[model samples]
Target: MKVLTANRLSDGIAVWYADGGWAETVTRADIAHDKAAEDRLEAIGAAAAANNEVVDVN
Candidate 1:
């Protein structure tokens, strides 16, 4: 399983990280900035922030 953390960029894009390494960078345009996607990411961020662990789902 791969753990990932997403950081929202100033340009409104999200950059993905895994184990403190860069995984990928996704823009809002890439996901169409949908509510579902935003909510999902927010949930992951919240979990990560609370536990100080990357969220992994595989």
Candidate 2:
């Protein structure tokens, strides 16, 4: 399984990709159970980084 994560650019808060936005907790984080899902999450993370919404995406 995999979860997209990053720190908020404004306050450096740890966040996880949930639904269609960043969440402060992992309980509701979007889980990637396959390669395709993982790829989608990675793309979201990359876009977030490019928009300066988050950093340290993983």
Candidate 3:
């Protein structure tokens, strides 16, 4: 399993991808249970980074 995480570029606060956006905590983080889900998370992370919303996504 995997969960997408990153730091908000604006305030450098840790965040996790939940539902369709970033959340301050991990309790509701979106879980990737397979390769396809992982890929989706990666793409979302990349887009978030490209949009200057987050950094160090993993």
Strongest candidate by lDDT: 2
Q: For residues 1-58, write the lDDT of model 1, one tens digit per residue.
A: 2333454433333456433333455222223156776565556667655664433321
lDDT of 2 by residue, 1-58 (tens): 9999999999999999998999999999999999999999999999999999999999
Could you tell me the TM-score of candidate 3?
Answer: 0.98
**Model 1 bad stretches (over 4 Å):** 1-32, 54-58
All candidates' TM-scores?
0.39, 0.99, 0.98
Residue 27 in model 1: shift from native, Å?
9.1
State the weakest 10-residue window (summed lDDT) of model 3: 19-28
Instruction: At residue 15, give the lDDT of candidate 3.
Output: 99
lDDT of 3 by residue, 1-58 (tens): 9999999999999999999999999999999999999999999999999999999999
Cα distance off (Å), candidate 1, residue 40:
0.5
Question: Any idea what lDDT model 3 has?
Answer: 0.98
lDDT of 1: 0.44
lDDT (Cα, 0-100) at 56 in candidate 1:
36
